[model samples]
Target chain A: MAKGSLRINEISNAANVLLNVIFILLSFLCIYPILLVIGTSFAEETYLNVVGYKAFPKVISLDAYKYVLSNAKPITNAYIVTIITTLTGTVLSTLMIALYAYAIVQQGFKYRRFFTFFIFFTMLFNGGIVPWYIVCTQVLKIQNTLIALVWPYLINAWYVMVMKTFYNTTVPSAIIEAAKIDGASELKTFFRIVFPIAIPGLATIALFMTLRYWNDWYLPFMLTSDPKLSNIQMYLKRILNNLQELLNSSSAAMQAGSMLAVVPREGARMAICALAVGPIVLAYPFFQRFFVKGLTIGSVKG
Target chain B: MVKTVVKQLKDKAIEIKKKKSFFKDLHDNREYLLMIVPGVLQLILFNYLPLFGLILAFKTVDYSKGFFNMDWNGFKNFEFLFKNPDVFTVLRNTLGYNLIFIVTGAIVPVAVAVGLSLLKNKTGARAYQSFMFLPYFLSWIIVSYLVFGIFDYRLGIFNNIISGVFGREAVNWYQSPRYWPTILVLLHIWKTFGYNSIIYFAAIMGIDSELYEAASIDGAGVWKQVLVITIPSIKPVIVMLAILAVGKILNADFGMFYNVPMGSGALMPVTNVLDTFVYNALKINGDIAMATAAGFFQSVVGFVLVLVTNHIVNRIDSAQALF
Candidate 1:
């Protein structure tokens, strides 16, 4: 029996060691491609052709950076637009969603059941893109404007439900009662007391919002025709598509220009991805502790 | 008492009774009602309002006719869609890829999560979790570019390594249909496994530590404990997520397929799915109505699947039903 138990323990230990090694190797696989893009972006195009993408470049060059930066005006504009949209959109949406979530949590609200059903109903069905396009373009008249990107995605029902779940779970009844006894108005109670405690919950949603705004290319592609209003992702896509078109066009000078354009394409994509995700990634560690707490509180009940 | 005073008194009593009932209802269920409003409004504007536009699917659109003034085509648009020979191909590709994605996507993440949970050291586990999650943050476009770097026939790492070493011809991955399904599945797992694993990890963590202790006391090994305790504890969550995924098996990840394939016609046989098909058809024909019909079909099928799955779950275990 002792020998059998020892054998079982040995097998378990072996499996554990193997899993750790595999997991670490898998992690490297995920990170290396991203690093390759960065490395190639900084490497001379000639060197890249010679040595290919590597952890370290054969010959270091800033031609890609110089070309990208010289043509940086459009990218800069895109960054400004994306940042404004993400910040304003996240703040506005978060507030509106929290307000609505709070109202739904109040048992005394007159239309609670009706409203819940109304919200849940939308999850099941939606009118396709045509009506939405017509409504936004013809009725709202937001075509070729940044507002088109911001307005359509300003509120999401799923986020609201998640917020409501957090509120119901974490914000204790005693705290609200204490605030009420202290002569706090309903609005005051929400804005002052509830909002602070819900920051971690709000942060999770905000990270998602930032990601959505940063990654949004479809909206700008479909709605906006003007180049100036294009977000970074859209601009990058246009550049890539233009490169393909240029490759097919069979113009030597244009091909050279497209090759030159490829310089920024990888770095800029990495840069934009890095820039867009940098803050959230940086901020995530701070919220990591709270996230587990929030998830447990929010999900276990539901 | 005067007749006028008696009439005024009766009117005041009726008003008070009405107010009291309203107040009583409000007091009984105010919190539940408040919790639901924001979600309701968002749905109304973003979701329900778009739903009203489903009318466009039935119309033969003309720029001159305006949105509302377009001629009604009844089922003509849908008929056009069904008539196309490629429609069936696109549908089959979409469903086939998604079915593969669903099955593999469900399995791999759970495996990864279980593996991560078994790691003894906290720091190593955290580092692995974060690194694995890095791919999920990248946009599909960036991922496409990264894929090109690996599979770029002329200068790709694969070609450089294999052809250089073996003196063999380099495979043009973009042109090969047979290899794409595997490539796409691999990419999907790489990008998503970390994000999905978080849920399973949380579920595992929630399992009672005492259960493991009990198993250990019975001389059961780690693998046996996992089989007996951890799997059963988190079965509900796994089941819930699987059902949710089944609800949308008809909908493909459009961005991944569209961007990764990057308009390589040679690979369309493997890469083209329903969403991309609709996108391509609209691009070629500029037919808003037909595209909307496709969208409507997808939405309806997805909705019915969710309802049916929910019903099945309800029958088996009431607590697991999403609603």
Candidate 2:
């Protein structure tokens, strides 16, 4: 028996070592591409052309960063648009989802089934892309407007369902009952008691909405052709689609004649990407902890 | 005659009371009703309103004449969609890629989750998990840049490695359709497997520790423990997620198909799924009817798949079914 247990231990130890190596390699695969992009972003264009995209910079240069910042009009405009849209969309969507979710969960609320079904039906079927595009552009007439960015993602039914589940599990019923006994109104009870207790849930949904709004390029791509309304993602997409458009069309960048001649085309694109991806990567730890919790809550059998 | 009139009056009074209570229920929950109105309105505007516009699939739309003024045309757009040779390629690519994704997606995540669960060093496991999840946060546009950095013909790291490290001729990755299937699948797995693993990880975490303890006492090694306990314990979650993925088999991730390849015409033969096909038809070619027809086909088939899969799941395990 002692000999058999010793053999088991040896096998288990070997398995553990193997898993560690595999996981470490897997982790490297995940992060190496990101490092490559960052390294290329800082590399001198001439050296980059010669060396290709090294995991580390061959010769460090700030010309790409310099060009991007010096031609800051479009980038800044995109940042402002993205920031405003993300904030507005996150806040409004969270509140709307919370309110809608809270209402449906109320035991005494009439039309609860009707209201729940109204949103849930959307998950099962959609009008597809073309009709959605037509409705946004022609029917609502939100083309080239800020509303076009903020409105489409305003109430994701999946998020609403998640928020509803969060509320069901997180919020205690006794406090609401007591508040009702004291003659507090439904909205007042929710705003004061439920909302305070449900902060974590609200934060989770808000993070999701923030990410959704930040990463939205499809809306601008489909609904609006106007450059003035482009968010950061859409701006990046436009540059990605046609690199020459930004380099040549931005007259200011072109007027900086000597720099334009050395305009690290590949490096500049990577720099733009690095800049766009920087914040989210930095905040990923925070997002990951909450998102894991949110996903589990959402996945729970209701 | 008097008795009959009295019975009629009684029925009328009951009807009036029922009508009043219906309004009373509405009045009682007035605040709750008010709260959900905005969400309901949004649902109607974005979701349901577009359903009406689906008729455009069957119509010859003329914007100059306005939306409602379009003439009815039956089967023309769909015929055009089917008559095009590209439809078969798109359908095959979409279905084939999705089939590969569903299988690998389930297996890889489950393995990762199990591996993480088994690690004796808690901090190392956590760190590894975090690193894996990094790719999920990135927008596909950013990922495209990463792909470009690796695959860019002259200067990409892929060529650098092949020619410089391996002493082989560098291949133009974008221009080659044959290499794209593997490239795209690898990219899809890289971007998602980490995020997907989280769900399975959480499930594994929830499994009873006593099961492992008992199995170990029986002289079962790590592999046996996993096969006997871990896999069976998490089988429901694995099945549930797989079914959900199968339901979405017809709908490819648009961002992945569209942005990742950077619009390489050569790669389209392998990369052009239904979503991108519809997008190109609508945006690039300005063939609204063709795009709408394809979109309509996808939606109908997709809806049916969801319903059918949900039915199968319900039959096997109602708790796991997505109702």
Candidate 3:
């Protein structure tokens, strides 16, 4: 077993080829589901009603999209709500988290440990949804408002901690000291000097914030009472679950029987799925670079 | 190191106080302290305040009187969960699905990371990664529809494939409980393995290439090198991920259990866990007390499990212990 051999190299090369084939097959499997949804969404709803969705469509139609777009008001409204919330939420969450993270990392700050524990404690225990719902509705009076969509997610404990670790390790002390030597205010140093250098880390957190706000339906579903304020994901879930459209079939037998009776909804469901996933797919490559850099630096966020 | 730094920090503060005015040091850092105000305030309002609402778990809310006037009924609130008729089914599904996820969660990521690492072409690896990462970027709502698209019995791709291949009737996937556990596991793996693999892939990348070189020089075959080199190189990351996963074993992802099954009453046997059950109860009755009880039950059980797990991990290996 001591001699380095040509035969083993040949075998390894062959094995690499086999592995490549397996991964390509696996990659195709991953790509195919999303394609099926996209293809079916464009396919005539009747074709799926006859034979279901296909990996590749036999016929093409835009009826599902047309049906969805016909309800253009709600879709546009939800999209607007999602867009506003995503933009506002990511910016605010990233800023506040970076600020807090930077504050805690400074050795001169006396309460850093206490503040760290204060934020960290919330991660370990939560009051669950009922009370959270109560506070948001009863005390804060956020329900049925646009604010409800963005308010709850403004700061996540995990992201705050990640940014804290990022600042602690990456933003060197020498930079802050150099700025202080010039009589720069703490705020001045942070904004003018430190924040620029920390953009990569901030962008990483921003990517997470953007995705969460874009994809979140839970916050809206629980916090907001107004359908006008509902996000797109909730709208999709509503369509998927609202079996009441299956006629006056309140009975269990009829409900189950009538599930297939709601055939058009299947195509509509895929259309909505595609609609919801569309923006994320378009925007992901921009965030793709930050993902590897951020995750590698602070991989514990999960 | 954290303690040593804190100790030195206190010593410096004391010496600085003796040399200068106390207000000077406090004045120096007040801006930094001010920076933290919004974060602390938001956290207290959102995260910690709800912790105070955990008291509702012990109370029967009387909306006429508000939260302050709610009746303290002792453990009577917990009766909602422990006394529910579906208690066994809900517990079974939550624990069962979570266990399956834990096992798959450990194995699938490592497998993907190893497989991806073996690729020679960076472009192809990146493309494959993009495909895998695609599903993770999508929300559960979209994922549910994507899954339903394939399993829609009458019009689903799976039924058509089987029927076309086997000349058999399409199975009604939604109504049938027999296939869900497998389907759910497969979906769980599919949605997650891509993201999880990246963590292990990063760890694998960090392993010394020299070890692999040494192994190849010793005439190790690909399989042997992978066994002795790649897997062992990523062992710590694998163990860390597994330990963290075990901490969350009692808690199921609500979106997956709720949305992905389309919340079919027929499939609830296999799908309804504590989160969805509590959600349904709250949705129907608006009974804050009962809902809090369920929530509290999940949190308490999950908390205890985490503690026990961390303790065991601490005993075995202190560095990997979460605390």
**Which pairs, if any, clash in model 3?**
A52-B155
Encode model 2's per-residue lDDT on B169-222: one tens digit a residue. Answer: 999999999999999999999999998888888877777676677788898877
lDDT, candidate 3, B1-323, per-residue tens: 99999999999998887768657756776898789888888988898887788888888877678878888999998886688788789888888888889889888888887777776666777777777877788888888877887898777788888897788998988898888999889988888888888877777777776677777799886768778987876666677666667766667888898888886778888888878888887776776677889888777776677778778888988776667
Better of 1 and 3 by TM-score: 3
Regions of candidate 1 where Cα sits further than 4 Å from its true position = A1-11, A244-301, B1-41, B63-69
> Which CAPRI tier for candidate 2?
medium
Ranking by lDDT: 2, 3, 1
Task: Please give, for residues A48-102, the per-residue lDDT of candidate 2 as tens digits.
Answer: 8889887788599888888777688888898999999999999999999999999
User: Candidate 1 chain A: minimum summed lDDT over ten consecutive residues — where?
Assistant: A1-10
The lowest-lDDT stretch of 10 consecutive residues in candidate 1 chain B is B31-40
Maximum-DockQ candidate: 2
Global Cα lDDT for candidate 3: 0.78
Interface RMSD of 1: 5.9
Please give the RMSD to the true structure for each candidate, in Å. Answer: 5.4, 3.3, 7.0
Q: How displaced is residue A14 in candidate 2, in Å?
A: 2.4
Give the per-residue lDDT of model 1 (tens digit) for B61-81: 676877678899899989988
Rank candidates, DockQ, best first: 2, 3, 1
Q: For candidate 3, lDDT tens digit of each residue in A114-193?
A: 88889877766677777788888778988888888888888887888778778877889998999989999889999999
Error of 3 at B228 (Å): 3.9
Score each candidate by Cα lDDT: 0.72, 0.87, 0.78
Candidate 2: segments with Cα more than 4 A from true spot: A1-11, A255-261, B1-15, B64-69
